[model samples]
Target: MRRITVPIALLALLGSAVPAAAAQAAPPPSIAWTACDPAEEVPEGVLCATLEVPVDWSRPGGPTIELALAKRPATDPSRRIGSLLINPGGPGGSGVDFAYFSGSAFSPAVTDRFDIVGFDPRGQARSHVVNCDSDLIGAQYTQLYPDNRAEYADLRATNRALALSCRELSGPLVTYVDTASVARDMDAIRAGLGEKRISYYGVSYGTMIGQQYAELFPSRIRALALDSNMDHAQNIAGYQKWESLAMEGSFRQFTSWCDRTEACALHERGALAYFDELYARAEAGELNPDGQPLPPEDLVNIVFGYMYNPNSWFELADTLLYLGQGDGGQTGRGEPVPNGYLPVMCSDFHFDVGAYPVLRAIEQAQNRLAPHTRLNPLAWSDLASCQNWPWKVTNPPHRLRASAELPPILLANSRWDVATPYEWGTSLASQLPSARFLTYDGVGHGTYWRSDCARAAIDTYLVELRTPAKGTHCPAVFPSSPVSAQAVPTVVDPLPQLTGPFRR
Candidate 1:
């Protein structure tokens, strides 16, 4: 879990600032592309550019902020259909880095037909960034379980202080980094590319951006494919509960695999019991002091992080074995890799945690129902810190409806996605008047990177404008045996393909 800030009185200024410049006829925004700097990671023919967008859409001409953009042009420009704008869904994930890293992964057909483009959302890396106290963040880390009322109170206070620190450091842009704003930014990118209608590929929180863009400018979308969908319809408590349940399910799957597979080092010792012992030891703070000892929360985080993709299961198993043997010093399991989770998430949903007692009740209930996911407390409590957040939430949770004239948007989700639950994909599909849902009967979060079925569907939909039939299901594919030529190995598979190349 990552830490975030919740500024106080943030909403009071909404619409209170100088009213947005009145609607007026104006020239479309244009991007001036330039050759990217020499770098090993950047592919040939990829161009980078920076465009300015208003901090407030209402005032499109005022207080401009620079947006970083990058593009990998179609291999066959003559055959190009249009620009394919992508958002990798950190709300903080860098679209620019994603395009450079994963450009080659797309099938040749896609590369030939589309100019792949990516941009860093406002207040994200490579764009205008949100700064805070790195030391404070490093020290506090994420608090997975609040053992008592005082601990919960301390957590809240720490959150409040952090929010203030971030606001002071991040400035006004932090208050404006909502999905609605990013959706508008997408439209600008579409215009800058000189495309009448842009195709889209959004995953995770990126799905929310796609949904909002559909609602706001449905006519501008040529084709949309949202993977690992996010249902922005739920409020704070509901959102927390949904995530908790999903993580609990993934936890069970992980332990079950460990129990049945001889490949798992702890199998003979009873994987479930081993896990229980690890948790108990963590809680007791009895692990060795070889380096930086991991608390119970971080041990859970390490396990939970690897649960996103089973390809990493072997590595996860190895990591657990080392920790269990008291061999830990500094572990990557709990290291903080910030992707601007705070500004966007806090601006989108308000977590309504009242007094300390209220938080206590919520934590107790979640623990009772999902003990394995005591991790939810930290993930959820971070939201409540927004109560006094200085910036107002510009876009609260709401049902999104795509225009009837829009093409049927494609949705892909795995059956056991802990980060963005499969249920969310299904729920989002139902809400959209025009949608085609493809279910991957596999583990992990995003599907296109790992499942052949998913890739085929996405390719057909994006390139041919053909939607898969409703209720389409893709079967799970396990790692192949050593002697079996039929198996596709993804042991080091990254959870979401686009961000994989950049992962530390």
Candidate 2:
């Protein structure tokens, strides 16, 4: 999933085309941008605009699509150094939101250097948004039924209907939302900005977009920073991690944080004991924090939901703790799992479980690997969506290494990031010749390289095109990520892990 924006003044990207790669992989695609409302200006230094593109690049001219876009101008136009486009991680992340939320952070020095930009890619967020209607809503990525497998068969049928719905609603657009096409869109923005080369900073899936763009338009890069790395070469199949492991990963990180605290509910002699007891209570169908029957599996989904952003870590711990607390602590709500987390998490990735059987099969495989960790919502998400998706499941290639010719790329990962494991980023970095690795031994995703030294290194790179030493570990807490000349974000104190599930 991709949030397609960064804060910058303005520029162009196509809205509605599908990738020519799907039709013919020979030559890469190009983009043509439609006029967004450029004459109109938003409050302050921002502007609102749109890029009209084809839904499917394969049939580029057949149908048109629109991408919602925004830009935050450089504070000093006199010293502006083209545009610095930003894309957040989620395939479903909102770039416009990222700019709105973090665009200011890059201000003063960074904003003076480049205009920050953000946009929602087609089929997600404000672009060509996708909706599965009500019936498909609750079924979401669930195993289906009232926790019944047989009922899941029916849910599978419903999921197939979702594909049909997408086909009908999205038409030519659904197929073109791949990274390669987005890369082409990047080129369009570069052209619109009137810059021969484009500078960019992408996180998570955005990193993959940056990867594809660099691969296709090597000469077009001025300066680039890729925060979290993704193995786009892996395709749709290896995406199995979307399942329970997603949640399990978060659980491990969250529980480890709790292990250091004595009062933490699940903080038995350690996190493991607390977790064991907590699960036993959920398994026994005891009263959950909300007073509803703890489905036992809801914890997985909740934890899985929490792992995506560092901002949620504290809430995640408290939420989990509250869930396992029964009616004694909080209000007597009905269920343990908060109802809100599902829509946000499920919407982040379009698993389209209707067509992929391989993901479903992976469920049994997961149990074999980590039986105790299996059945959690994250794992279940990996499996359930595949079971019901409309497409066939096949192998997606893995990128043990990336093409060596890209610009200086930065790989950042936190040791305890539940959403993305640290090793994966390092392994991906190991694959690229022009990349460097920074490990944050602290908590949270993308924070591994969040320190000022790391920031200064990155900031200096963007402004002067430099790279940090090949392998460096930022032991002290770092800033969220890097920017031009960043010293590092200093917190008053190390945030403690919020209390969570109390094991026996």
Candidate maximizing TM-score:
1
Reference-based lDDT, residue 339, model 1: 33
RMSD of 1: 6.6
lDDT string for model 2 (152-210, tens) is: 66667755665555555545344455566677766766655667778887766677777
The residue-by-residue lDDT of candidate 1 on 1-504, one tens digit each, is 112221111111111243234212234446788988676368778899987667877754457678899988898988989899987777667888777855555777787899889899998888777776664455345542556777766666656666666666766777788998998888777777777788998877788888998988787789999988888887666676767777777777777776777776666877667777888888788765376667876776667677667666766667777888865434232322343566677788777465667767776666676776564433553455554455667788888866786778898998887677777788888888789899998877668776878988998999999998888999986543223323453322233554442121
Best of the candidates, lDDT: 1
lDDT of 1: 0.71
TM-score of 2: 0.73
Residue-pair clashes, model 1 = 14
